[model samples]
Target chain A: MEVKKERSNNICTLYVDGVLDYSTMEPFVEKVRSIEEGIEKVIVDFTDLEFIDSTGIGAIINLVHEANTKQFEVELCGIIDEIKDLFETIGVFQIMEALQEESD
Target chain B: MCSREFINEQPREINKTLEREIKLARNIQMKLLNGKQPYLENGEVLGVSIPARVIGGDYYDFYVLPDGKLRIVIGDVMGKGIPAAMLMILTRGAFRSAAESTHGPGETLTAMNNAMYNDLRTLGSFVTVFCADWDPKNNTLTYANAGHNIPLTVTSEEDIAEFPKTKGVMIGGLPDQEYSEESLELDDRGFVLFYTDGIVEAQNKDGEMYRMERLCDVLLKSYQSNVKDIKESIVQSLNIFTEGVPQRDDITMVLLKSR
Candidate 1:
């Protein structure tokens, strides 16, 4: 997978392309982990994402946890229907919401 | 000179010992997972798990309750290999303890989440589980989900769909999760298949997934067969599709059929 970052003001958008899976998750995890401190919000764009395995999902969950700890907003956008369904089934959105609520 | 040779062999000896220990761990896991299949009055239940590595994080179990209800659970830990395998044992222990006291599938999941939540959070991992209670007397299956894929119910070649939806966060995803339950009445000759993501996600040499549609087609064709045969059909189909490509994740499933 490939991640391209674009920054505007305090918000940073990450465009993910190709499959985010077990074999290709390291770079994505590194990118999410290395988000700059000054960013107030992070948006992950999944329009070009083709597939994600459980490991990939774990990486995203870790990112959410990091966001919660760092007190930044994280938004997932452009997720295709299939990935969205998978995320819903696995309660990714619920975790995000739950952690966000706890922080609040 | 002799001391130098002994030192040179020390690393090899340690490697061999580690390999032996891993194999022993694999054996223990297999023994625990492949324990006796619960006998039903008018139905059959079977579970199978194939680890991608020597040991895996996928788990499934069958517990025959005092009321004659069979409690079944299938789960996938967040990662693979040894760490996940260790967590799988933790999950199995929690499920076994909870199944004994819980009133239903939903309660069992709540208890499991309560039991394992802190450890999973500390480890930065999670588990997706689906739990169900099969009542032979009523031919009804009541189930709850915790971030796991819903099982499919097959009545006939023309009728196959996912189990009714029940929502809950994955174990360790949040604290104090209360899983909700859903029920389905199975007709005679109907069956339910609970599986992990590995089956549909199985990839071929061409990097193409096996997909749910193909799985549904296989289930449709094998709906009439016994549970063991149906399991074989699925394994055969996967083998045919994957050819010699190595498995990437742990595959697990439990089949409950009403006769």
Candidate 2:
């Protein structure tokens, strides 16, 4: 997968393209880890993402966990219906909301 | 010269030991996962798991309750290989202990989450599980989901439907999750297939997935067969579709058919 980073003020947006799965997750993890300090919000755009496996899902969960620890806002946007259904089935939204609440 | 030779030989010996240990671990996992399938009074149940590596994180078990109900569970732990396998054992232990005392599938999941939540969260892992109780006397299946895919039900030759929606947070996503249960009354010839995502997510040489459409079609054609035959047909179809491409995740499924 490819990640394109764009920054505006204190918000950082990551545009992810291609498949995010076991074989292609390292770069994504690295990108998430490399998010610069002082950013108030992080946005992940999934408009171009084609597929994601359980490992990919786990990586996103870890990112959410990081958000809780690091004290930043995370927004996931442009999720297609298929991926939305998958995220819902796996309770990704619930986890995100719960962690967000904890941080608050 | 003697010291140099000893160092080289020591590395080889350590490699051999590690390989042997991994093999032993694999054997233990297989034994626990493939233990005896419970005999149903008027139905047949079968479960199969094929790990992508030497050991996998996928798990399934059958427990015959005191009231003659058969409890079934299938789960996929996050990640893969040895670490995931270790947590899978933990999950199995929790499930086994919980199934003995819990009244229904929902309660069993709640118990399992309570048992395993702290450890799983500390380790930064989660598991998606689907638990169900099949009552042969009444021909009914009651099930609950912990962030797992819903099983498919084949009621007629031409129609298949997902089990009614039931939702809960995945184990380790949060503490003290209480899963809700849904029930389905099965026809005498009905078939229910519970599976992990690996079956549908399997990719071919062209990087194309073996999508649900194909799976549903195969199930429709094979639903009339016995549980074992139906499972084989699905496996055969997957084999043909993948065309020798390596599987990315562990494939697991449990089949229940009213006899």
Best-fitting candidate, measured by TM-score? 1
Candidate 2 per-residue lDDT, tens place, A1-104, comes to 79888899989898889998778988888889899999889999999998888878888888888888889988999999999999999999998998888887
Give a tens-digit lDDT track for model 2, residues B1-259. 6456557777778688678889999999999998888788798999999999999999999999889889999999988889989999999999999998999999999999999988987887899999999998899999999999989999888999999899888888888788989999987888999999999988899989998999999999986799989989999999999999988889999999988
Locate the minimum summed-lDDT window of 10 residues in model 2 chain B: B1-10
iRMS (Å) per candidate: 0.9, 1.0
Off by over 4 Å in 2: B1-9
TM-scores of chain B, in order: 0.96, 0.95
Error of 1 at A24 (Å): 2.2
Clashing pairs in 1: none
Global Cα RMSD, each model: 2.9, 3.0
- Candidate number with greatest DockQ: 1
TM-score of chain A of each: 0.95, 0.96
What is the C-alpha lDDT profile of model 1 across B144-203, one tens digit per residue? 999999999999888999988988889988889999999999978888899999999999
Count of residue pairs whose backbone atoms collide, per candidate: 0, 0
Which candidate's lDDT is highest? 1
